[model samples]
Target chain A: MIRAQKIGKSFGPLRALSDVNFEISQGELIALLGANGAGKTTLIRILAALTRPSTGTAEVAGYELNREQQQVRKRIGVVSHQTLLYGEMSAQENLYFYGRMFRVPDLQSRIDELLGLMELKKRRHDLVRTFSRGMQQRLSLARAVLHQPNVLLLDEPFTGLDIHAEELLTRFIEKAVADQVTVLMTVHDLDYARDHAQRLLVLHKGRLAIDAAAAQTTRAQIVELIRE
Target chain B: MNSLQQIYTILHKDILLELRSKDIITTMLIFSLTVVVIFNFVFEPGSEEMATSAPGILWVAFAFASNLGLSRSFAREQENSNMQGLLLCPVDRSAVFTAKVAGNVLFIFLVELITLPVMVLFFDLHIGPVWLPLLGTLILGTLGFATVGTVFSAISANTRSREVMLPIMLFPVTVPIILAAIKSTSYLLAGRDMSQVWSWLRLLIAFDVIYFVVCFLLYEYVVEE
Candidate 1:
């Protein structure tokens, strides 16, 4: 469902990603672990077709980056540190806007279901700005998966989520994986990544340093890889 | 959905947001009114200076109001990185540009609509038979303002000093539109026949077309990170 071949990115004299290569099969939940400048978000942005790579190539859901950006964008969902939601608008309006953007059929019902699933049905009409951080994150998740994307890219989704919101997000992600949706998430939470992800990919200095199954690698080794 | 549906969807969202927050429209209307009110005090209402300067004052107010509105509109999109969310959709980038332009035009036109009547009343001008041509001139000028303003707003939004950047970048490129609009409005306000305003109107139409096409083509690049 996702492939990258020697994907590289440079910001002037600084290199953000260097010859990074990875692939995730359908239904796989890969946790991308990295330090602050390790280029996880850059890679995610490249795969989402939002940023053009300075070198190499990437394909998501069988569509090549840049050349088939619209097609690629249609199949993927993204949630970053920012909620990507309008604070002035209601939760329902945000979902409706995205649904219409994606041209999702039966959008009203889909929005209702997602709102209910995210436990936002009661506050659907409330302005998003007035919501709590957790509530906003949940709504952001709902906005992300609103179109039923084939690929889900989450960048530090748990940054400010509370325990309950974190659990809710985990379960939702599990459900998405169960439905054969590929997910690539970047996180600073090592324990959660090891516990929830099927595989782990660590980036050190903008390079992929480790690619291993979660069960086969312990927490100590993962920590060592990140520090190294 | 098709491109038209996509455009309408975006435009609807913008309109809905504005209706709820009254952010862009309210700021623009108030600012434009303030400009007109101040200018009314500066120039005597029934004097010959007022007759010659009304068009310039009107468009200057409009230009400043547009700058405010465009900056606020794009800043709203940049909030929470909503512009990236918009870009992530399956629609063409040009559709997004078109919708934004439409939204800006509507907001600016609404400001113009409210402010125009106030200007006429404040200056004690007799528009009489020229009202229809004046309307046409306003729409053309607003369209051209929006067409150029939308693209530059997007560009400036990415910069650090966006508030200052929008006007700095927009005003230079929009000279032809403002010049033509002011000229056409002046002729109509002077009670001249349509024959005189026609050439300025034609220039406005040309600027609108050229800017729309060029901006439509360049938007895909401008918005890309």
Candidate 2:
């Protein structure tokens, strides 16, 4: 579902990714492991069709990233630190707005299902500014998946969550994975990655350092690979 | 869905958000009134000078006040990177510019609806038969304001000091609109026949068309990440 062949990105003298090569099949849940400046977000941005690689080509869901950006964007969903939702808008309004933006078929029913799924039904009418951080984060996830995208790109999805909220997000992402939504997530929580992700891809200094099946790898081994 | 439907979806969200907060309208309305009252102090009542300068002062107040509203509306989108969200939609990015232009046009029109009577009363202008032509001038002028304002607003929204960048880039480009609107308005306020102002009205329409199409076409590059 995701392919990056020799993808390289540079900003001035700094290289964010160098000759990165990888392919993620449909339903493959990947926990992208890396340090800061390791190009996880850069790679995610490229695959999400938000940024272009300087030297190589990439594709998402059969659409080339550079040429078919709109098509690629329609197939992929992204969740980042910012929720990408209007604070003054209600959760329901936010979803409805995205529903129409994505032209999701049967939009109202899908919105209702998402509200219930995210446990935001009771508070759907309240402005997002009044929502707690955890609630806002949950709504962000809900907005990402609202379009029913084929690919999910998550950058630090587990940050700023209380135990309960984290667990809720964990369950949501797991379900998305089980349903064959291609998932590539950048996460710092190695234990969480080991437990949830089927494969571990590590990056260091804008280069791919390791790629291994999660079940065959230990937390120490992954950490050692990243440190190297 | 076609781009119009996407444009409508964005326009609806912007209007809905503005309705709930009323921040942009309130800010614009109050700012306009303040500009008018301050100008009221600068010149004595009913002097030939004030009478001649009133249209210029009024359009200046409007141009500046509408900038405040345009900035605020985009500031709302900038809050959560919602502009980025809008860009990621699978439609042509020009829809973003059109929808925002429509929203700002509505807000600027509402502000003018309040400001016009206040302008008339405050400036002691005679509005007999020229009201229709006067309203036409206002709509065309506001279209220009909302048009160029929407373009520069998108441009500055990406900068570090948007409030500083907007006026710097916006003011010079809109000289023709301000000049045309002020001249036509001056003619209207002087109780001149509408036919006498046809040249200026044509100029305003021409400026509106040129800017609207150029801004629409150039918008994709401005807002691209």
Candidate 3:
């Protein structure tokens, strides 16, 4: 589970996130909804242990976010719009590299499984630079989950993906939640988020404006809420 | 696995990539040789005065060639947001810095290895039994250069004019390493006694230790998103 209490972040005179508080329980797929510059990325970075919040505390997987950052990092998997794969390396090599970093046992078979699951088996040996955007996104997903992290954070994961790729990603997210992994992602596509996420949290001008179970929320309501 | 092992894996990957493409090595070699050839023509060889200046010429070639290689070290990562991929790994950011320093050290050493033979041939200067000291100087000097260079290269990699910004930022900070390295190399090449050369060697070693530790500590700040 991930919990943030009064999390706030600022840059000089500009405030990014202020007094933001939320909790993500195990097996919950939470979609973070915010327009550009609405603090989704900042909040995610703080939660991912990549950036320190200006105030408040975050606890993830029973570890205090600020005090036990390493532990928090170890429990989390992340994928952003930037597919963090090395362009010169093959998809398998990139997975192998990350697996080695995370100290995953039986790394080769783990990589193979991820490649097969991502439908990248035939292209596993090809350099990431040669792969199309959708292919790279799929591989990026594989890289993030290489260690089987319990908590996953994805920023704009579906960007630039085709319908087929989007379907694959949706399936991946569903399986992740089925396996009891806590998933949090930011999205602009309300329809996709509406169908996929178990909960929706909206951010407006760096403050939480709406938090509700997905089943209770309506697309029109979310659209109107964000538009405000 | 430990942090060192992770660093080793990354370093090994970089080295293997370089070996396969030979891109960095070839450019460094050609550039270093061109600088050496130009120096040879500008200064008459085998003259007593020329021997005194050879050490400076050799180091100038190395510093420039090293900068060339350092700039390219992060080029692959800069392209297509690969750096973000590397950063997303849960590994300590310092490991990234260390791996880059090690890779740059290896490339610089390889370039030195190629440049050394050519320096000897072009300058007609016999290095004598000072090979050990020369080798020590090369390794230590390269360590200092790579330690600081890796940090600044990473900094410049994020900037708009990375190609122009790297040298401007790197050269000024690295003046101490270049100076100490050139001084020590000159003393060693001249067959000076160990006692006389000890101070400059100490300076090089000191610079290497300080920068290596400082850079390791400060890396997390530079890499933080």
Please tell me which predicted candidate would have the highest lDDT against the true structure. 1
lDDT of 2 at B197: 91
Best by TM-score: 1
Docking class of 2: medium
Look at candidate 3 and tell me the lDDT of residue B100. Answer: 89
**Position A18, candidate 2: lDDT:** 96
lDDT comparing candidate 1 with the true structure: 0.92
TM-score of each: 0.96, 0.93, 0.95
For model 3, how does the per-residue alpha-carbon lDDT over B167-205 read when each residue is reduced to its tens digit? 899889888999999999889888888987889999999
Question: Would you list the clashing residue pairs of candidate 1?
Answer: none
User: What stretches of model 3 exceed 4 Å from their correct place?
Assistant: A218-221, A224-228
What is the C-alpha local distance difference test score of candidate 3?
0.87
lDDT of 2: 0.89
Where is model 3 chain A poorest over a 10-residue stretch in terms of lDDT?
A219-228
